[model samples]
Target chain A: MMNCQGCRDDLVAYLDEELEQSMQAQVEDHLERCVSCRQEHDSLRQSYEFTETYLSSLEPSPYLWTRISAGLRGEPMPVRAPWSWLAARISNSAVAVRLAAVAILVLGVGSSWLFYHERKLTGQARQEMVQFVADWEGLDVSRVNPFLARHEHPVDELEANPFIDLHHHDIKNPFRHEER
Target chain B: MKRPKTEARAEDERIGELQEWLQRSKQQDLEAFHQLYQRYSKRILNYIYRMTGSVADAEDLTQETFVSAFQNLKKLKDDGKFESWLFTIARNNVYQQFRKKQIPVGSLDAGGEEERSEYERIAAPVRDPQEEALYSELQHVVNEVIEELPEKYREVFVLSAIQHYDYKRISEIVGRSLASVKTDIHRARLRVRDRVKRYLGQSS
Candidate 1:
């Protein structure tokens, strides 16, 4: 025999006829032994039946079906396509492709011009270093060991010095795409 | 007279045919596409209406739902539960509307929200009036309570209680385990029961 609480717990399933025959028999035995449980079960049973009956009778508002049918057909729905389509269009069109190629050509010419310009500046810098060394030698203002002996440092030594190479090395190429 | 009977029978046959066509439509059958639409358009509309509470939005969502279903029918892994799959899409569209704050436009009634939170809450408050006066009200409460449930629970309860689906069928429709479906429905019923008790107490 089932307890009142157990019977009550299974009441909803029982009312819906979902319990197995053996379980249903146990519930019946419990209900027979307990009137309060029986009464509560009866009330729950009535409410569920009432809810089902009530809900079925309530149809969707008039024209609800008509409007929904129209919608399912995509007759008047509005939505925008995604942005990737625009990017694809700009990238794929003949004109866009040509424009990209022309831009690449312009960039290539500009880079070469910068490289040549840098090389010319480096040559001018080396020439200036040589002139400065010559002028310093001609100025030889440090003399006069009573015999007026000149401390002659060779111009070639100054020219061949590592310091000259440090100053003469080209500044970094601003447009160099490749790592130096 | 013969033509009217023939037409009615034809319509019924067409609906049955559409259900069949829906399966093939998942494989990109255009003929199935047209036939399915002819049969299920109204039913889908009613479903959307119940979800959104507005005919205009229901109509728009219904159209989008079908077109999307049509386009992505291939993505439906389970063909036997096509109607459920379709409704899932429709449900998603309706939820999307709610997310956009477009449904029940122009109102933020707290009572409405409360009623909507669980079927039992709204249903419990309903009095036993004459069948005519109370029937519509009961339906209203049912709709409201269903609306109030958390999305996952509400979906199961609506499928089982309102749609009258068996737990196995609902599980198949929703792609969940049968046990999970049963538990969701049970929890949903418990929530409704609490609401009903509260409503009964307040009304009395």
Candidate 2:
């Protein structure tokens, strides 16, 4: 009942015997009468056999095993540079465990100290901001008034209050890991 | 092709032994890794040869694959997956070579039907059956056709036909579905058939 196109479509799988029994029987029936489809199947089979047979004859060089073994022994490792082994050597060594622990300790302590210093600076900046705002508003620089002397514009009174810490940086550039 | 029951049992036994060898190789046992190399190096070489069609390059890449496998053996989470894992590295090595040549290496998982058809049309030109019969015996022609296949089809075809890897293992190595592997391999055969036919036509 199968046509030439259907048989041809199933040719590769049919050659491999991958078709189910019912479908296989249909394909066989078609190939029995359909000379052209049968020839297609034969051609597919020849190509498969040729490729398989030719490819199997290939053998690796004995020197390949020597090279791989030498590579395993670390004879100037290929791909990247020789120093790439440093990462592997370091990771495999027992010292890596202790180093990891020390790293964790340093990170935790450093973050905690950074938090405390940030809070202190934030408090100082807020206090200075409030004083600066109050003094600037109450005293006019161009006015000669008694109030100017009493208030003394906290900015003038504050030693080097140039640029009051408006941004409140607990540590300037806390994200800088190298400085930390 | 369906493996006979006895062959299946032998395969299971081989995998069992391979797992044991891998465990020993993990302990810096050079002899164990050598056993593994003996078992697989040639097969890997054959696969690479059909892939690149250069014996020298295949040998070098096979060596590089094993060496990389040894170095990164610790990263292999499952010993049973060693063969697939090693093949993945080998595939990557081939892709890296293709990258050096500035060729766009296609991934097995990235294959679309339209692209497969496009590549197949380009690679395989139709011809008479009698013509293909002439070049069937031409090993050099066979090698060239296999090399001309797109990488996506090339991986499946080489693994399935040349190396005799089952679809399941091929799926794992190529990182594609079992069904896709089967289809690519079949299409691969059809396309190779046409390419051979065309080669005969041109030669005639």
Chain B superposition TM-score per model: 0.60, 0.73
Docking class of 1: incorrect
What is the per-residue lDDT of model 2 for residues B1-204, given as tens digits with 9 covering 90 to 100?
A: 599999999999998889889988888788999999888887787677656654445667888898888888889998988888989999889879878866566322111222223222343435577754543346557756776788889888888777777778999998899778778988898899899788768878
All candidates: DockQ? 0.06, 0.15
lDDT per residue (tens digit) for residues A1-180 in model 2:
898888887777777666789999999999999889888888888777766654424555455666677778878644432442343334343655777888899999999998776565545554554444445445332332222222334445454565666345366431122322
Off by over 4 Å in 1: A17-25, A56-180, B1-19, B23-55, B98-131, B141-152, B193-204
TM-score of chain A of each: 0.35, 0.36
Residues A1-180, candidate 1, lDDT per residue (tens digit)?
A: 688778877776676566789999899888888999898777666556655765531233334334434445556533322332333334334645787898899999999997776555545554554445435435322221112222245657866886665345687522222333
TM-scores vs. true structure, each candidate: 0.50, 0.58
- TM-score computed on alpha carbons, candidate 2: 0.58
Q: Which regions in candidate 2 have their CA more than 4 angstroms from the true location?
A: A1-4, A17-26, A29-33, A77-180, B1-9, B104-137, B200-204
Please give the range of 10 consecutive residues that has the lowest summed lDDT in model 2 chain A. A141-150
Measured by lDDT, the strongest candidate is 2
